[model samples]
Target: MPRPPLPDDVAELFRRPNPAVVAVLLPSGAPMSVATWYLVEDDGTVLLNMDAERARVSWMREHPEVALTALEEGSWYTHVSIRGRVVRWEEDREKALADIDRLSRHYGGQDYPTRDRARISCWVEVTHWHGWGAAKAD
Candidate 1:
């Protein structure tokens, strides 16, 4: 499906130096939020990494549905929100390790060797995306 338009300020928030923090809703209706180094691919998918055993990961396992939002540090008014499902999760030990390396190199400014030492991680396939920013308003 075609992705919804991302508000200009929201887009800029994702383009910030620090990775955006996302809030994942648990099956119990509680929200588990965390800061993650992420990348938005040209295909309209947002990729994030977290330990498999983390609360959000556990919650996602039970309920793959989730919502993600990102906002600039100083301005809560400027932000983006995405509602979607986690369509894929790589549980293979080797692949998860490799993904962590790749993600770190891409977002952490580290070389391959340096990147491999980062935490193990998993992927979240964003099936739908919708966001807006206060900065985009008149």
Candidate 2:
């Protein structure tokens, strides 16, 4: 099986603005998951942003490993899951702000609703991935 982005069929599912849930490890090594907005970059990396004050930001900084499952909108069974690590963390509020705006436009068709809060962004380098349902690996 291919790693990370896989081929176009599986990758295509991620390109859409689908609902996604990201899972990360807590300090106790237990898994925690939260629904989040994500973007698939041209190079196949995943982009994610969060409020700087959120605990998940600190948790991700402490444990870079993460898994994201992107489900095709309106068709939950068709999905792709990627296991990856945070390759870069962007704390520059300006850059984070811009990235979040881009994500909001992709997901909600407008700029991020809140600008008062600082944002942080992370780039995930997918290491392994697989798909299920219509996107299932052959």
Candidate 3:
């Protein structure tokens, strides 16, 4: 099936730094989720970052399929859940750190502390999205 287009309102919602949770499939086929920071690219892909050896990253690497839910800062019901697959992985230290910093400013207001390990940047191509801000179906 063709993916849905990300409307302006939904795109704007993703621009904000809110609560985002990523779900990936483990080796055993079980689902695992983690809270993460993300950026929505102009091409509609979701940019996610983490330690090179993190479980989430490993799962995504091995499985490639993942889901992300970006929620409103103060409202749990206001959110967008995206189902996508990892389309690329960028492993440059400088770029990865910068990305985390960019994400930090969006979510935490500043920089991310302690960047000791190598970072992995995963770009997921969005295939589907569900829910809308507060209470409207988009």
Question: Which ranges of candidate 2 are over 4 A from the true structure?
Answer: none
What does candidate 1's lDDT look like per residue over 21-119, in tens digits?
Answer: 777777878887777766665655667766655667777768777666666567766666666777667653556466655567776666345323334
**Ranking of all candidate structures by their lDDT, best first:** 2, 3, 1
Candidate 1 clash figure, as a count: 0
Backbone N/Cα/C clashes per model: 0, 0, 0
1-138: candidate 3 lDDT, tens digit per residue = 225676667768877887888999999999998888899877888888887878777778899999888888889888888899999988848675887777778778888886788887889999887866552453
Tens digit per residue, CA lDDT, model 2, 1-138: 358548777777789999999999898889999999999998788999998899988888899999999999999999999999999988638664899998999999999878789889999999988888998888
RMSD of 2: 1.3
Error of 3 at 40 (Å): 0.5
Top-TM-score structure, candidate number: 2
Of 1 and 3, the candidate ahead on TM-score is 3
In model 1, what are the clashing residue pairs, if there are any? none
TM-score of each: 0.66, 0.95, 0.89
Return whichever of 1 and 2 wins on TM-score: 2
Please, what is the whole-model Cα lDDT of each candidate in the order they appear? 0.60, 0.89, 0.81
Top lDDT: which candidate number? 2
